[model samples]
Target: MATSPLQTPISTRRAAILQRTGEALEARLEAERERIGLWLPVALGAGIAAWFALPAHAHWIGLLLALAAGLLFGLLVGWHSRLGRSLFVGSGAAAAGILLIWTRALWVAAPVLAAPVTTSFSAIVERVEPLPARGQVRILALPQRRSDLPPRVRLTLRAGQAAGLAEGETIGVRTRLMPPPTASLPGGYDFAQRAWFDGIGAVGTILGEVSRVPGKEAAAPPLRTRLSAHIQGEVEGSAGGIAAALVTGDRGAISEADEEAMRRSGLAHLLSISGLHVTAVVGFAMLLAMRLLALNRRLALAGLVLPLAAAAGALAGGGYTWLAGAEVPTLRSFIAALLVLVAFLMGREALTLRLVAAGALIVLIWRPEALVGPSFQLSFAAVTAIIALHEGPPMQRFLARRDEPWLFRLGRGIAGLLITGLVVEVALAPIALFHFHKAGLYGALANVVAIPLTTFVIMPAEALALLFDSVGLGAPFWWVAEQALRALIALAHGVANAPGAVATMPNFPPWGFAFAVFGGLWILLWRTRWRYAGAVPLAIGMAALLAAPRPDLLVTGDGRHIAAALPDGGYALLRDRAGDYVRDTVAEAAGVDAPLLALAELGHVECNRDFCRWAQGEGSARRIILASHGRDRIEGADMAAACAAADVVISDRWLPHECVGRWITIDRDSLAETGGLAIYLGEAPEAVAALRAGDAHPWRLPQQLSGNDEAVPKAALAR
Candidate 1:
């Protein structure tokens, strides 16, 4: 360079290139070091936090100790590292803080022990069973099972005469209390699990005798309860009983026809203190608060008034119902309303993803057991969708345009309704299938009509009724409210009975539900394109759906009769009792309307004394024949002969047959010259295999055997 800068040429150029390369490599290394230093501590902290937040029954002392160790290790790593040592140390400390918080939470929960058995008490009849055929009665009373008492303990009375019971009637009963049961079969409702999280346990009706006690009428209802009751009474007194229920969660006064109408129209959620009801109350309250605040110059006054308004709304919505003897849904609503108020107080222009996540995290951490409940899942799912949709560019752009025509505004409103319907439907469909095995086809349409009417008319009317009652003008308002409610009920009923209002699907396996939920959450929460990876679970669910096996036979009513579909494309009925459930079960599983019609169309329906006879006539006899009762002795004998000739026979009760072949037992043992196979319907995998292997002709046996043959094959097998 000293000699001549330009003349140094090739050697200089090569040195320069090498230097640049080295600098680039060093920069990359430094960046990598910094990234690791930052993220590693965060990961560690999250792990520690999770460990501490483990269920109350989980070991926490060991976890806390391990978290301390992790912090020490992280600190050592930072000290040893040259680049970004401060960053590493800071991250480690932050992680340690997170872990400490979780650990402290765990300790706080340690005091909660298993609930002790307490003396059983009685409940007064508040409402009779809405569905008489279902034989369920609902009661409200003080439950002695303090540990197992639901936030709102409603007794489900079985095999009891609820008809004569009126409101304010008390009855005593004895029963052992326990947590509600989990869903054991696919597509089965997990009412027990829901009740458990809500703090309910096993509830039974009075066994031998029930003595009715006089109900104590309140001289003056407490301020809040009085207001609620007054609102309800006034609305029903004026508009109709149905209207009061739609607004006040006082469905006891609603007529049976109105209740049915609401269910059919999918407007039932509006009548309950669910998320929608809460949202309406909060939304209107917020609007009113904003207007009032706009009029007030003092910022302090605005803040106080706003929060007070929110609290008032929460009260009106039944958010604090549990504390005031209302309902669980009301409590949930209150929690959500509080979250919204907090967001507003924070001066946020829009609800952020972080805030939503934080709210959900707080709720989940506080009530982890709520994860098992359909209400929590469905409510949160709907909220999440609302948040996402509200933030989307399309919605934002639409809202930004203020100069749009009235027609366009109406169109936008309609669009909003459709979007809401689609989002909620998608979110709840999986849960509905998992729980109810049926989907409401017109849920969206029902919501469109029901939500608006309830929000603008019913709820407001009830609120006004309360004011009128306070001023001694209760009777007039009550009559008006009742009439309005009647109209709403009629609307719901009409929509519910409309053609194709509900779609019933085959019961899916529990794992299918699990995967579907996982997929949905992943899609909803994950921020990256990689989130699409959740589709894998969805695909697996679809595959499961396709792979589901159809049952060959279904028996209902104490298994005295059966409806069977033969391989020869024929349907046969062999039952000592009516086959309605069996027929419906088969039709539902097959996704066919009028299975009998299909059978007739295919010329498979035949009047026969024995299913085996029908099978033999068509030369397409099944390898196995399951008889619900032992009444078909001749059929049983023929089935045994078939078993001797490479077939299998399964019966609910023992069948007497001497000329049959060797019997195949589930233990893989062959009984000499009996032809009767004693294959345990409910056996372990190994036992099933043993039975199959020990049998001389395994393939000749029924393709499958199950206790509940009507259930989908995978679900039945899982049981």
Candidate 2:
């Protein structure tokens, strides 16, 4: 008979409890041990991130990194606890990642254009990507006879100017070229770094019609261009562009409206030629090869179909990857697909976190710089999430799909697809928000239909079309594919237009992003009760991201646009006449969807020919002085009065020191150094009162400050 708790000896009860606790601890350790190596990629990525995070101007960073390397090396070789050893391995991997990226950066570094220029130049067109809807063509050309210029320049030609130009052809043009641009705002995409890596020094726009010599013989155009032209010629409207993107990885012909719709609907991944596309292509090729080989009785008896199928899959994946331009994401997907094919050959389960981890490791080793990109993160995260979901006990049983009725099996398939879509969407949400400041709210729902449509209907039709097109009998299949694309594009636009489809927010704090990533990895990589603990940090990160304060005012690097938060819940621009690039950048950073209002039209400011003063805050707590009209130089007494009366003075022109404002004085000199400034009012958080565009790197050195390059005041830089 079992004794009651009160009747049992205290020592025995304590012993039982302690034994159970020990068992649990051991189980937890075992679970961690099972997948600890998977964290190697994460560690490597962290190292890459650390390298990017450190200021390039910091001379001691190298020494700091050396110390870290020594510590990690010691931990890696030393005998330690299992958890401790795993942690050390991760650290060592990170060190390796840092070194890899450093080497890659130096290897790919190329000369960049320092300033804008206008010249008449002859160039050999290496590539010509047409933009039919926009009546333009973008060409990547090797400029001739100019050693000072970069190896290549990307240029755009308007309708008339682009006539008769093709890849591998030579043409002359008079154009104004600009150095590749830095981020328009802090943490935005930097085109200059990408340009430097791609060996593009400048981007240009033709001033007039291009000068093409008469009867000039040139090499044939690239296969990709001809393929795109052929597909577009056969298919009409936007479907042709979609077909081209799917087939040749060229989206230049896709209409801007349709592209934006895809982005909003979260269907843009379809055009990216990643895992979905590669897997579909590989799977079809394997199935086809297996079926054809199985027709032979000897081959079937020998069971060679499976082996041949694996080979075919591998070949198909590699060929498609190359054909699709082999970008980082595509390469990562291809690696994963190849692993899947290998799994088939070895008779092992293909969908597993190990597969994801291995693919990630290969990619990080090959392209360490890609660690910072949204594509790499999204592709890996989505695949990992799906695999983790399948690894769960419930999913394992559900996916077994025993001998059931056809209807029930179909229902299970639908349910599985929906579940996977939701899981992928959840996995990608934080990544999307972190990089893009936006997330698709209904992306999963849209993809539920879109993915199957593309995989089972559209892609198969396209394949059949391509096969039959050699015999000129592909019209029927092409028509079917075109109809499917119409449905897909319609779905994209419809979902994008739905209410609350896209969620936008202010640029969240980097620390919050770090927390989210850590939490996500913890949850996805482990299979123990402790993994749920990750949700706490994840929730906290989401809170911080959603609740972060918005800035009250923003000043562009050039001091050409100054935007302020309006009392009624939008932003008012100092100048609305400027191009949409700056306007859109400011809007995105501000995290508002409303169009910027013209400050002058707001009718709240009192203005003179020299300046305009907007009284803000309780009892005019903050008076903002905005320089106006063609005047910047102010007489001593007048400037002193202006400064004393206003709390903040913002001007693109030089402001004298004697006329310092009551609070902050911002001028062209300060703007030149700061790049851009986002100022927060109210009870400013410890370090969030003002944020700058951050320190410059090699390709993004600060522009020169005009009118006495004197250092900005300490008070101005303090926040």
Candidate 3:
């Protein structure tokens, strides 16, 4: 077909305009990449995500490809040549994927997973701490024979039976070690991956009696461990636990009830060694050093006073980190503080998102698996949002009026704290929902009281207590610290007990989380009006809370119990009092408020010890039956009734042959193979096995299906 000359020019002009627009967009993207200084962290995070997206044990291929792509990108970056939009996007994504694959491969390289075994071996106890449950303790041990395994393996034992065990003592253990549990459903928690990164090769309970053995030479108890024990020995009750937690990052001694209170009140962050603690420690040291220097006029005039004070503050932070055992969160705080110090020394603004990004990059490069943890996400999100909000024009305008009266300054300070707390809470709400499926509603009210008390009273007393301990005069200071902690605990409990103080929601899907995260990063990272566009994704992410589909039934991974969705937007339990954790997990996932009450109020479910029956739809719908241990001739009547009444049956014991023709029976063998099941009810009911719904991966072990695995209802037999 021939075209007119006028039409041809118009098409050509349109093509040119489109090309120019694309070039402008590319230019804008490039400018953003340079301005944000977040490329490395984003790339690293993307790599981790890519690794998770792949099939288990398939990271090797991805690693190789990532290596090649990384090298190519490095060369291009080194050449100082402008990249086209396609090349830039491709190279960036490829580079990120490479890091993810590398991290996964590195994780798999642990010797325990290389050649897993389940045999008894003598090990040396590195440390021992009591579990939340009474009469149980967790022991961190070093294996004598399996030197190829991880440096540490966590073992559980009955404290009453293993009372003689001590740190640095050799002990004989008889246990079958196994890998950690994987996610029961997609986007669920992956304890196996977490354990892998924690350097825990295997986890198991002690089988036989513990006996003292002489295998390895004794080593001294860790300095941090000794200090924690000393603190515990000195004080009593929750106060001692709080004191130890503040000083040594050991919260094992804290009671579960108190821990729950803190979590519900949003004072949980106070217990963790984070930026707040680091800042308080450093500020105290800096102020004391400066005052001492002022007292000595000659030293103050030496011109090294400022530098020395900065170094002293940094040294104080490092000392506190060492005291806290240098855990991941503390390490992150130390690195961030160090970056800020360096930036200040260089005569640059230390408070910026770039500092946070730098800290994140360092942590990711050191331990990429941290990207998956709630602590990392929450810490980084809170810090980033605070910095973005405070550094922006809004805060600057609010604080622009300077040299006000003392009372006015005090009021402004309180206002600033309120604003900061609100921003942090809002920013981290999505992450809390995605990871924990809940948000602390009255957290702001609690924080208003707890934060000031902790920062001003509790932390200072702790510092003085530690200082006095070095001089063997710590009792009075320690008492003061305990008093502060007591007050803080009381506040947390009171606030947590408030009605409607916690909001629970279903776990957001991975894509939903991604949308929220990107939306947040968009608002935080961008320097233009386009940042407001982030609200689109944020809204979509929030919509997921209402859009997520609720399962008709939730079965535990071990298949001990199941919860059926009720018409009143609650769950009905098949059992009254077994598998509380499992029941709570299911209820939390379904966003149920009171699991026990929901179960108690179920009118549709009718059951005894032998059999239970429930129907979802009115007519012509499949009926559900829970068949327990009833295999005798008398119980045959119950089985026959279930077969006649229900279309699908889940039995704890063996199923009789006569029932197989009439119903789809999920017996013991089926559950042992599948782990769990989620049944969805509709016009056509569908039962999805937890194992079948998930990918075949290392974290999730394989289950063998025997020839008898197939059990179809007689209604579908003709088909």
Per-residue C-alpha lDDT of model 1 across residues 273-390, encoded as one tens digit per residue:
7666667767776677657765766754555767766666655555435423455455555666666667776776535544445454555545544444566666666767777667
When 1 and 2 are scored with lDDT, the better candidate is: 2
- Under the 3 Å rule for N, CA and C atoms, how many clashes does model 1 have? 20
Better by TM-score, candidate 3 or 2: 2
Cα deviation at 267, candidate 1, in Å, is 3.6
- In terms of TM-score, how similar is model 1 to the real structure? 0.61
Candidate 2 residue 77 C-alpha distance from true site, Å: 9.6
Model 2 alpha-carbon drift over 4 Å, by segment: 1-27, 57-80, 402-405, 606-612, 616-644, 653-660, 685-696, 701-719
Best by TM-score: 2
Using lDDT as the measure, name the better of candidate 2 and candidate 3. 2
Candidate 2 residue 444 Cα shift, in angstroms, is 1.1
TM-score of 3: 0.85
Indicate which candidate wins on lDDT. 2
C-alpha RMSD (angstroms) for model 1: 12.8
Please provide, for model 3 over 1-719, each residue's C-alpha lDDT reduced to its tens digit, 9 standing for 90 to 100.
Answer: 89999999999999999778866765666666654456557656766765665644456465646656756765654434334433455456546555554556465544343333455566778777754224478888886644434556788888775664679787766665665565554345667767656656677777767766435444556767677777777777677777788888888778777887898788898889988888888878877887777787777778667677889999999999988878778999999988887887789999888998899888877777777789999899989998988878979888777888999988887888888888888888898888777788778778888888888887787777777888899889778878888888898898888888787776576777888888888888776677798999988888876687776776665455667777667777666765556665676666666654434346766666566666754556545555453344434554576576666676666566655523456767777566566666666776655454345443444221111112223232211
- TM-scores, all candidates, are 0.61, 0.88, 0.85
